[model samples]
Target: MTDDTAVQARRREIASEHLLFKLIEYVEQRHPGLLDFLEGSLDHLGDPAHDETKDDEAVRQIARQMITGARAEIAE
Candidate 1:
């Protein structure tokens, strides 16, 4: 891909992630403990694809942990 293409792709990725976190915040505000429930439900899905998406999966794992950490901080 061209440098411009890669930059645009990354911008879209960041925007998508921002939208996701905003949605998560909306759900948590509307449903209270529901985000925690959803996070717990995703535990079974943490399996590695063991392929090219491993890096993406790793980043997602970090995002998941970040959400958990943020919740923990809110609790404190």
Candidate 2:
């Protein structure tokens, strides 16, 4: 990839990670132990047998819902 493409990819990755972290923090506030559980689950990412595609999509859907709810809360 070209330098510009690589930089763009890295920027997108960072943005997604930041959004994920924010979503985790929001969930953690309401559901105390969930962040710890998610942290523990991250270790499984290195496993060859673990399939993360479905899990990742599920998380994205949930995060979108959380963002929508948070926006509504803020607008109130």
Candidate 3:
């Protein structure tokens, strides 16, 4: 991709991540179901929780999978 496309993509990613964090904060603040939802989804997908890893790799992987699945579903 060109420089412009790369920049735009990065911006999009940043915006998405920001929105996701905000949503998590909102859910956690309001219903406190956010943690349960995340853990449940990850568990259903056969992934481990935060204590399973000291690094963020597992969290990143789960986030990517969730985003990809959501995108595909939205596209349909």
Candidate 4:
């Protein structure tokens, strides 16, 4: 891919993650009971839904590891 395409892709990735965090925040606010609900859901879930578009394997691996760690922490 061209440098421009790569940059745009990264921007999109960052935006997606930001949106996710914001949604989590919104859920927590709207339902204070969701602290446990969030943790429980994270524990039940595995990695991100898709790993195919992850042309950048390094970023994909990092995301997987982070998600795994978060899930483990939640379980504890």
Task: Please report the candidate that would top TM-score against the real structure.
Answer: 1
CA shift of 57, model 2, Å: 24
Alpha-carbon local distance difference test for all models: 0.70, 0.62, 0.62, 0.58
User: Which digits, one per residue and each the tens of the lDDT, describe model 1 over residues 1-76?
Assistant: 5699889999998898778767777677777986677667665555466876656556558767868855664455
TM-score of decoy 1? 0.60
Root-mean-square deviation (CA) per prediction: 3.8, 10.6, 11.6, 7.1
lDDT of 3 at 55: 47
Model 4 regions lying over 4 Å from their true place: 33-35, 41-76
lDDT by residue (tens digit), candidate 4, 1-76? 5699889999998899767656655665566565555544543454443656534545445655654554454445
Global CA lDDT computed for model 4: 0.58
Runs off by more than 4 Å, candidate 2: 47-76
The 10 consecutive residues of candidate 4 with the worst lDDT sum are 40-49
Q: Of models 1 and 2, which has the larger lDDT?
A: 1
Clashes of each: 0, 0, 0, 0
Q: Pick the lDDT winner.
A: 1
| Cα lDDT for residue 22, candidate 2 | 71
For model 4, what is the alpha-carbon lDDT of residue 10? Answer: 99
lDDT of 4 at 25: 56
Model 2 over residues 26-71: C-alpha lDDT tens digits?
Answer: 7767777764565455534442336554465466555556555554
Candidates 2 and 3, the one with greater TM-score: 2
- Descending-lDDT candidate ranking: 1, 3, 2, 4
